[model samples]
Target: MIGKLGQTSRRYRDDARSATSRRLVIGATGVLTALLTVIQIAAMPAGPTPVRHPLAQGSVWDSVYTAAQAARGEATFRKTCAACHGDSLKGIDDAPPLTGTEFHKSWDGNSLSAIFTKINNDMPSDNPGTLSKPQVAEVVAFILQYNAYPAGKADLAASADSLGGIKFLPKP
Candidate 1:
């Protein structure tokens, strides 16, 4: 009888251990699941972001993006804007700076479209009245790129309507 009782007690002990182990496993799984859920929620996309479009659609000058246009704009800026805007586009005397604090103030509460118009109408101080629409657009794009603005799919050349909405992020 005593031996039987001892075996029964051992069985009970084994059962208790199994129950505890199952509870522990369930608790650990719950924790892991909760953590995974949090991570998934955090990684979801949010807010306005650049809609990447191909270069053929537009370019830095055309008011859209096309690898071809950005390339062309780059060349245009080098030929025309490089003299006063500096090789790096930092800008020379009497020419409003294009990056850093000066850039922020020059464009505070302003629209890119307006900026484009100003450049198109009055630039190169020495030869202000002779730029073509596409040429002006290319130079404007170079300035945008210099200001650290990321390229978007659509070129910003057509009109100031869309450009007015995209606000500039001031640099430190």
Candidate 2:
């Protein structure tokens, strides 16, 4: 009976040792995982701050498109944009108005280049992105003329960089 008791005690000790070892291993694994996660996050490289376009900081009051260009733009607008925007650019059903208080409010304090990019990529519902660079510039000029912005002697350039250099300002 004593020998049996000794054997049982030995078995109990062996089982307890295994359970303690297993718990130690699990705790170590959790600690190691947390350490590795922290190390990975710390090792990651930092990214640069985003830079705003020069035009975004400027104003539409600055010299821009010419009167002749606006006239040409008006002609193109009549042919291409009149259907959806209406003959007077007042907009139709589902299409937002392209002029007046609402239009100016939407574009106020924004970059002209952003507007140009939007029009270049998407316009004329049935035939989006079909307008040429110069044609796009002309249409922009027409919109500016309609808004009553002062016209300059030089024409507005169609390039993104040039357009971005011109900011959209609130009407005086």
Candidate 3:
């Protein structure tokens, strides 16, 4: 009976030691996993930052285009867009007007980039995608001039990013 009791106690000690070792291994593995996750996150590259321009700080009410640029745009419009939109920018047939109530309803609260892209990709019904970026910018300037938007000293840039920053608000 004495020997049997000793054997049982020894077995219990062995079992306890085994359980402790198992706990230690599990704890170590959990800590290692957390450390690896942190390291992986730290090693990853950051995302690209957005570019901001001082000229595009506000809506179109801030005079984002030059009068000279608008004149150039008007010339281009006469040569390429007048036939469909009319010499005075009133809609003719299927072509939509670029001024007044209809124009404001269609374009207000939108970005200038929206109109620039539409004109760049789909103007001059006979020759879509033929106008250059600068020409498109000029055309947009002319439209803004006709809508009674004030002119700035700088010409409107031919950049989509820049235009995207300028909002087409209602006349102000």
Candidate 4:
């Protein structure tokens, strides 16, 4: 009877040790997983930071482009953009429209600088990045005019920093 009792006690001890080992392994795995997650998050790249320019304080309604500039932009558009964007500024196959409600839906509340950058970087589809900064500004001016935005005495500047300050709001 004594020997049988001792064997039973040993079995219980072994079972308890196995349970403790399992708990320790599971706790260690959980901690390791948390540490790995923290490390990965720390290593990830941050998103784009919002740029704040003093000139960007005004909206496009403030007459940021001149009529002369818009005319120049229109000429450039005819030569460079009409094939894809159409004579009416309506989009052709795979190209998006650049005026009216579609334009507002895409660009409302965004900065002129954003559109300027896009034009400078990605316009003319087939001949991307070919337009000079001044040309891009002119194109933007023309687009504003086509949308019936009021013209000012000053031409739209080619400076992205300055353009960045002007917000593109839906026509009032």
Q: Which candidate is the best by lDDT?
A: 3
What TM-scores do the predictions have?
0.56, 0.64, 0.66, 0.65
lDDT of each: 0.67, 0.83, 0.89, 0.88
Clashes of each: 14, 0, 0, 1
Q: Which residue window of length 10 is worst by lDDT in model 3? A: 49-58
Residues 55-114 of candidate 1 have per-residue lDDT tens digits of 322222224434455667788777777788777767788665677777777776576677
RMSD of 4: 14.2
lDDT by residue (4-78, candidate 3, tens digit) is 999999999999999999999999999999999999999976658644344545778787899999999999999
Model 2, CA-based lDDT: 0.83
Top-TM-score structure, candidate number: 3
Query: Model 3 reaches what TM-score against the true structure?
Result: 0.66
lDDT of 4 by residue, 24-94 (tens): 99999999999999999999876687443444348887778899999999999999999999999998988
Per-residue lDDT of candidate 2, residues 97-140 (tens digit): 88988887888877788878878888887889899988889899
lDDT order of candidates, best first?
Answer: 3, 4, 2, 1
- Regions of model 2 farther than 4 Å from truth: 1-57
